[model samples]
Target chain A: MNNNEKDKKSLIDDYKLHITILFISTISLGIGTINIPLINGFNLVLLPIMYSLFLAVLFYIYKPAKWINKSQSKTCAEILLILISPLIVKLAIASGENIDILFNVGPALLLKELGTVGTVIIGLPIALLLGFKREAIGMTSSICREPQLAVLIDKYGFDSDEVKGFFVVYLIGIVLGTIFISILTNILCYLVPLHPYSYALASGIGSTSMNVAAVSSLIALYPALSDKLLALSGLSNMISVVFSIYVYIFISLPLTEKLYEKFHKYFN
Target chain B: MEIDLSFKMVSEWIGILLIFSVMAAIGNYVGYQYPFVESLIGMFILCLISLVGLIVEKLLPFDNIPAIIYISLIGLFVALPWFPLADLIIYYTSKVDLISLTTVLLAYAGVAMGKDLGSFKKVGLRGIIVTFAVIFGTYLGSAVIAHIALAYTGMI
Candidate 1:
């Protein structure tokens, strides 16, 4: 094969590896979260600690070289631990306790009391971890392939000047995308007499790959919709798997192509 | 609380174990050749056999109650631990789902983490902005289509 073709193939392979890792990490995060014991003498903090340790070990084992590099390793490890923390908290219920028993109080009252904690304990960490991991992977992979990408990134310096622009654009896209999709699904489910919250939970579970946590949260909030929530969770996951593939192919590919072209022109 | 065991319980356990072991053996053998196809084939075979049994029962014009009972018994035999052999079989065969799912998810997670954020950064906000836009747009588009289709089919 020609050098250009070989280079392209290698890039694609690298991208595939990234995609695979993301899928596994997300799934593991979800599964681990679901299995954590929230009650029965177990506290939520342990979940995060365990998850963080797991993440540290995972990164250390998978990319030993990164661990030796100090800064990158720290950032990578922190990002993974943070992203997986919420899921771990959510999974604490997987100790086989009846979730319904924990929320005997009415839905609104329960949500008011637990929602904030859940957000902090389960949501923020996951978001940060996901964002950080995505950034770290993206930056490192680019740096390896094209030193110029690294120089450009370093010049911008993450939050200032040039780098800020990219972050802003990417964040805007992700926020807008997540909101739009979440809202649209919520509305459509509402129109069909299906629970909007269940739909939201399902979408969240599917996209984020946090199955048990999302479903359990919904079940806690709406006990009446437990069966539907479970079914939707499964359905959404299957759909998400397909959607993720399409997203990788249709979105990542075209974007990568354009980036390479632009880099060639400006950096080279 | 101590649990009591009867002859029936022992028999069922033994049966389940036997079935599980056989399934596991077959599964492992196939898995060695094509790991990805393991669970898919197992699920497919189970479904297919069930379907055929149902069809045959219909063709024979069997009494509904008796047929239901027969199927229930068969299902119990397949699922229960009636024999010591059942435990061995189940232990080996029943892990296909877990293995395949874990493998696929792990592979995907690794790759997603490996994405190049520099490109997104290079294009500035535009790249990041577009990524979210496309993801949301696709999701919305699919939801709308699903909603319309469901509405048309009166599934809702």
Candidate 2:
């Protein structure tokens, strides 16, 4: 083969890994949309799980591609977040006609319904009683999502104790939050009656991926309410991104610190 | 063949759409029960949206806002209930399932965690404890308010 043909062959080979992932992921997602009956009687659609396993399998057996590398994967995940962000807006825009869910008490309902405030109020004394360190309290009082990282860095400066504390929690959140948030929100959808749209908005408290997981799971359950769920979730996530950091750092952290001190002296 | 990298990227995107569209068709026959054409159409609109997103980034005075943010806001406006195209656009956009969009993304996230195992281990036991406490606290906090709200609304 000539040099040009040889170069083209090498390029095609390089593209093979990426092409495989895309095709498999699409097929897996398609399958995920269907329910398969198990021998034990429960029908399972395990598409998300299947898709994840596909990636995991590739990571273990195939050559690790750049897109799957830690840093590169971070970029890919962020791109996914940005891509989905618009869909949420579209959902809200469409649903807004039905009830203007974004403006019509959506924020109040999401906060009240999701109980973001209650997480701090009830958990503060308990965390103090558990003897959590001040750093831990700083992390705990906030949902400690990605936006908080920037505010924490700016306020405390990097290398401070609080930064380390935030890093510790942030790491754990990244590892665990991505998965459990979907399951937790799914359980909430089943156990509560606060409206699917409320849960859609509530899911926006963390990263876009988490929001997508929670919203998709709920959408899977309540297909009829899909539009409102999308709109409310999009709006709620934007609010969480814009405002939750300020609320958590300024108000929640100080309040938790004072409570921890009061309890430490008394209990210790 | 000294291939153009940008052209290669575009072809790759098209390849992805082709694969997804084919799978979606199979899904229709296999039991997914959604229209097969919708996935392809939805992706087409997404491509248009992304193109506008890039333009918005170039035109805007401020650089802080990300292109995705602008793209999404524009999407929101386009679908705004009163807009001329709102209803038509929402109908098309709504067809593609969120699960389809998130499934592969989550898969990539899983791969990322796999790739980052070393970083996670560095955090050690303290990270685990802090994470547990944070998760517990947040859930407990939300549960309390949820209970009262449900009670007040008589939803229970």
**Candidate of highest DockQ:** 2
Off by over 4 Å in 2: A1-14, A30-50, A53-108, A117-268, B1-31, B111-114, B124-131, B144-156
Tens digits of per-residue lDDT for model 1 on B1-156?
A: 322334443333333223322333233333333343443344333333333333344345434322222332333244344534434323322433432322232232222223333443455543443344333333333334444444454544
Per-prediction fnat? 0.04, 0.30
Stretches off by above 4 angstroms in model 1 are: A1-31, A34-223, A239-268, B1-135
lDDT of 2 by residue, A191-240 (tens): 76555644665666645555666677778788898898787666666656
Write the residue-wise lDDT of candidate 1 on A24-95 in tens digits. 333443444333445322212212212323443355446643422233332332222212211111112121
RMSD of 2: 10.3
- Candidate 2, clashing residue pairs? A4-B1, A92-A231, A118-B141, A119-B141
Query: What is candidate 2's TM-score against the reference?
Result: 0.53
> Which 10-residue window in model 2 chain B sums to the lowest lDDT?
B23-32
> What's the distance in Å from true for residue A192, model 1?
10
The best candidate by TM-score is: 2
